[model samples]
Target chain A: MVIVVATMPIWLPATNFLTLTDGVLAGIYTLLGLSLVLLIGYTGQLALTVNVTYGLGAYTTAILTVDDKLNPWLTILIGVAINVAFALVLALPLLRLQGHFLAVATLGVALIGFTVFQAAPITGGPNGIDGVTPLSIGSLQISSDTAFAYLAWIVALLALIGCRNLISGRLGRAMQAIKGSEAAASSVGIRPFRVKMMVFVLAAVLSSVAGSLYATYTGFVSPDAFSVSFTITILVMVVVGGLRSVWGVPFGVFAILALNAALQTYGPSLIPAGGTDIPIVGYGVVLIVFLMFLPGGLASAAQRLWRSATGSGGPRRSMPEIGGAVSEESS
Target chain B: MTFLFAGLTVGAINALTGLGLLIVYNVTGVINFAQGDFVMLGAMAAILFAGANGHRAGLPLIVAVVLAVMCVSALGGILERTVLHPRRKSGPVLLLIMTVGISLVLEGVVLVITSSQSYGLRNFTPGPALSVFGGTVSLQSLWVFGVTGAALVALYLFFSRTRVGKAFRACEINPLAASLVGIRPSRYWTYAFALAAGLSALAGAVIAPVTTATYDMGLALTLSGFVAWVLGGLVSPVGVVVGGVGLGVAQGMVNGYLPLGLVAYANAFPFVILIAVLVVRPNGIIRSLAERRV
Candidate 1:
């Protein structure tokens, strides 16, 4: 892996571009991943509806800019509104379902979203809503790579702050309480259902906002972009980053993307004629290895190293793992 | 009338898929996401065999179906012992992810081995059409309906009449208690997996003539089965069949009666029903009736 990173520029022209472009992509995905961490990791809810919310954001921005002739700034707000409303409708009932059933239910939402985008003529069917006008100020278009990178960073930073505040505040405590035990939480007047629904909805709205900006930034929207694969990728990011550690998300995103990039660049040399397909094997192996060894994720690994370096002698508290269970059944 | 016959034919296939899903769900208590992949592999294997062994005029369709089922069941057993057994102690979510990972590996391997082109499993042509209930029906449709009905009846008898079947039921109801009573739950898991894979393979072999084999078809079918499972309340065989057929007919009806805008919603019907039922009744439509049994 180190050798691949060292020799990257020799093979991938995107190597220099990757340091910049990949960084931006990491930031964007981190935003989404952190939202998922808050939802699934801290709140003890399993939601596979991220892609649907994302598509809704993209569609909203596309429609507003292309059909309604609304400004890009206004489109962003509309995107958030649409996403929140959709999440509200879904969360009202979906929050009640737990475990595999909840996962299936959210998966249904995503599948239905995919079907709507692919089959409905108004949404351009499989062709998708394309030709979205790029977000711009009156005199200067926010079309350059540097500009868009900054835009993504700003949004990601705000989202990070929002998530951090939510996690540390009274609401965050209530959410953690709910995660620990819903019955106990409600007994203490936390209103676990409503709080969970609120967090889920907020997560959806944030993801949608990111999606809208992404569509406008990329100037394209396709059903292919918002697949179950994308949802899984986001979930993997949170799991690989150490859920509940807000600072770990970017590392998680970067780790996976870097691994993917490395496989794409140097995998062919390692296995003759394997080509780009080796990453398929790489991701699976990485997931299994991480799940077995580093269940707390890369952040946890870094924390261990830092603690050792500082010679802090206190016994470390075992991080409360919310959903992971080695037993056949998990609540 | 022809479309109704077509719908019925597809409905029978859905029944087979539902049956395959139920067997695994009953014994192992894991909703195998790779079920559709097994179906796809079965069809592909049969297609390859037919190409290599010659699609002879005298070869029986039953023989081809049996071969497909046997091969796929063996594959299921291999997968269960190798990947699933190690992760037997994991939570359902982790197991779910493992199955998905297994699915990803299977898809990549299949794509590399098989060409991207679709293949025809042409041996199962029940030649000629006949009149049935004021509609033109093919022998193929009749064969599918008959086979699925027979399979279900056989399954019902086996579950009720055989000691192994009784053991399987005991495992499903309560694995801990079943183990106390000397039933090997792990062995049951392998057996149930084999049963599900075999049935899925048979369904694939039957439907391959109508729909060609594609690498990614399994994922969608698996998702639909999940929707059916949710709609049917997960544990009831009768409810599963009803839900599966109802979903098929619902999609068919939307295709038949709706306008273009609404017809596009046909594919989304299962998901829409799923979300609705989840919101309205999380336990599914039969939850109230089956509360005591469950």
Candidate 2:
């Protein structure tokens, strides 16, 4: 499945379906979804700051490459480092918060990040910076649509492999233990704070890397691209794909983006009133429906369907319960 | 002095929005992310009903205001009954995301209907500005403050003296116990949503004259109101009011003293303060009685 998706640019356009640009977007969103899975799914931290981190990475790469004349590849590293630093600083105060409080705090930080992006003159004040150079090695530039698609997919694949390795190691067990019960994890010699901080930084770095690639690919960075809606879309993708599965990231990103594209392409023809707004409306409806009926998301649904079809299920795989009751007392 | 009055007016609006959030949260244990949209709905509905800004079929201002509030309240009731009530057993994260979806849909609908245009409502009573403490205050600002005060007083009375209000309080205290005493939590949930919607709409209507109304205004208002709610610890009404007003004043001061460049980022002040407060006192400035015992 990974090989098929990674090599999609080779054959996707011949079918006259999704373009190379869509592939690039799918790659970016998949990176974001995977990063979110690391934090929200694995560590049980409800964070909404992914978009801001993505913005930071984009802006960093855009400004560095455009103004400071730095190498695009080097800028990506710098952006990731800066994002990890920011995440650590943010996590210091934020790690203490739990549940809705943590979610709200991260949201506040994202909102603040957005306001700064809009207000800061260095960010070009909402118009955003342009003339972002594409990624290159020596004199060979990866600027074309097809080339950027390959670059994005290659990086996405590496990130996926790295994340899968991390999840299969001791860190993954620590994350699952912490997510299950922070108290129990700590009592059993796991440092919840350290594990949570590591996962948070890792997620931020991954998101920043995706953001840097996005800027490099598009050659422009705008405030509108990093809005709360973008964050919400990535979140929907993570939840819709299946939170606990690494393979769910690509599935979620591809499904939602395809749905959006299909709605945009065919919706207006089907309904006279349908226009650009149809995709947004479609997204809203799909998110709500999935949340209501398929809480474990499409990945789990697919697994269940496959098992039932083969009639080989001795016992059903239960969904990972994410609803840990944490302090319901109103204060 | 001018900043103080400006802060007071905005603070009153924030307080009302926070109160709306507090009410729903106390009853349902879920934060209504769409609270600010209710404010937007109130303002937009009033504008449309009053035939303001090229709108047809003008109604009397009082009648328009009442109709707008009622419409928004009914929307809140309908939303609670349909989308949320069926999924009440879902986790907090799912419920929160559901509210976000609801907010997106509400904003989308308003955007389509209003054509993404901003609208303004006429002040309650247009008149000359009054000079006080070396600062001129608009009559509209005074009206905003007056309405906020009256609403707060009325809300207090409703919560303390009325039977339905006591039922709301009972649900907040203990939903199971409240149900045993013949108070249905679901009924109060719907009521709390409507009440909060009405209050937020009222706030939006009053503030519309000053800030104007736009479909996209909900998120900012929600964030600011949420900041106030967090600062107040999400429980006490009086604390919410104080936090709201204090936040408004701090924002006013930032705008007054900061550089032009910094002033452009003044909207983030409450959020920054919210983070700081949460870090220092996760329970907020006013701790609940149960928390104090620990």
Candidate 3:
């Protein structure tokens, strides 16, 4: 799968389907989606900071490169560190909240981040900073769309493998245990707060990486680009693709992005002009449909099919529970 | 002083939104994110029926308000029955996400209907701004206060004096035990949602004259209302009312006193309060919800 995605630019014609820019966006959004999966899917902390950290990364890159003329590569490291610090500080108060309270508190965090992006002078005060310097090696300039596409995908795939490995070991078990029940996990000697905080910060770092790449690739950073709507869009992507499946996260992102692009191309004709909300409605309906019908998402469906094909029909595994009211179980 | 009055008016509306949130949350344990959109829908529908700016001949103000409130209440019940009923067994997190989905759909449908146009409503009662306590208060602000105060009293009475309301409290305590006593929590879910929708619709209708009806306003309203709800500690109805008023007054002061160049940051005030309160006291300013229940 990695090989197919990485080498697609060589063979696939840009004339018809996804262009280089869209693929680059996919790579960036893939990181954000994976962060969501790790935090919400694996850890069960409904802290919505994907777009916040992503914005931090974009702003960090945009500010450093445009204002201070710092090296773009160096800014990415600084952006990740900043996002990590932010996540650590926020997770302290947020991890104490349970279920719905935690979710809304995260929303509050998202809104505050948005305000700072729009109001702060350093962010150019809603006009946003433009004229970002492009990234380059000692000799190789990453100015072309195709080169950035490779750079983004290579980094994305590496992160993907890193996340896959990180969540598959003892730490992964601890996370799943916390997701199931904090009391039980604590009884077993896993500090729920530490585990949750670790995953949250890690997710923020991943999102920061995406944000940095996005700013340099787009060559501009704006508050409009980091609206709360995008955060929900990413949530829908993570949920629709597969919540717990690491490899399945991109499938959700690409599928929804393709759907959205298709809508933009064809929606005006079918729905009439000024029907921009059609795509939004599409996202919301897609989220509800996938959650109700296939909560495990495409990955679990594929896993079930694969097992049936192999003639060893495994007993159905229960859906991984998140932090919320266990109304049915408690009752 | 004028800023204080303005804050109180906005606070009343925020309280109404928070009240709507508390109703559904207390009865069903689901935070209906669509509550603000309900307020938005009511305002938009009323604007459409009563005619924007009172230039176009349309339904009378009373009739228009009733129609909008009734329609939104019905829609809320229908949504609860159709979209949320099947997911009743699902965990609360999924239910919360589902409300978010519902919010998106409502906002989108509203955007389609309104064509992203802002509608201004003529005040429900025709009058000049009244001078009270050295501050000029608009007549519409009085209407907003009247409506919110009436709602608070009615709800207090309903919860304390009516069997149905106590049944709601009963379910809040333990739905299973309530069910054992032949009280169906599922039935209350739809009713609570409908009631919440109606309450917010009334709030939006009354407040629309001051804040024009717009498609994108729902998100702000949701943010403000949620902040108020959290400030009340998510436990007490009366606490939520006080929470909403305090938040409103604080926001008003922030807006009034900020330098001309920095007033734009006041929009972020509620969010800052929300994060601060969530970090400092997730419960609320009032420590014990049990002692202060409506």
For candidate 2, write residues A37-95 as lDDT tens digits.
Answer: 88877777888999899999999999999999999999999999999999999988898
- Please compute the TM-score of chain B alone for each predicted structure, in the order given: 0.90, 0.95, 0.96
Per-residue lDDT for A1-331 in model 1, tens only? 3343334334334654356556557667877887788887677677888888888888888877887888878888888998888888878778888766787778888888887777766666678777788888788898876677667777887787788888888988898888777988899999988899889888988888888888888777888888877887787777678665676776778778888888778877886556667666666556655555565677778778887899885656543332132231354
Off by over 4 Å in 3: A10-17, A318-331, B287-294
C-alpha local distance difference test of each model = 0.74, 0.83, 0.85
Could you give the DockQ of candidate 2? 0.45
Which of 1 and 3 is the better model by TM-score?
3
lDDT of 3 by residue, A1-331 (tens): 7777767677434546666677888889989998998887787777787778999999999999999999999999999999989988888888898877888888888888888899988899789999888999988889897888889888889888998888878898898888888999999999999999999989999999999999999898999988888899999998877887788888888888877877777777887854665788788888878777777777777777776798875445433332112223321
Give the TM-score of candidate 2 (chain A): 0.93
Docking model 3 quality class: medium
Least accurate 10 contiguous residues by lDDT in model 1 chain B: B51-60
Candidate No. with top TM-score:
3
B122-168, model 2: which lDDT tens digit per residue? 77787988999998789989988988999989988898899998888
Best by DockQ: 3
TM-score quality measure for candidate 1: 0.88
Steric clash count of candidate 3: 0
Q: What residue pairs are clashing in model 1? A: none
Give the alpha carbon lDDT tens digit for every residue of B166-246 in model 3: 998888889899999999999999999999999999988998999999887887888798888888877788778888999
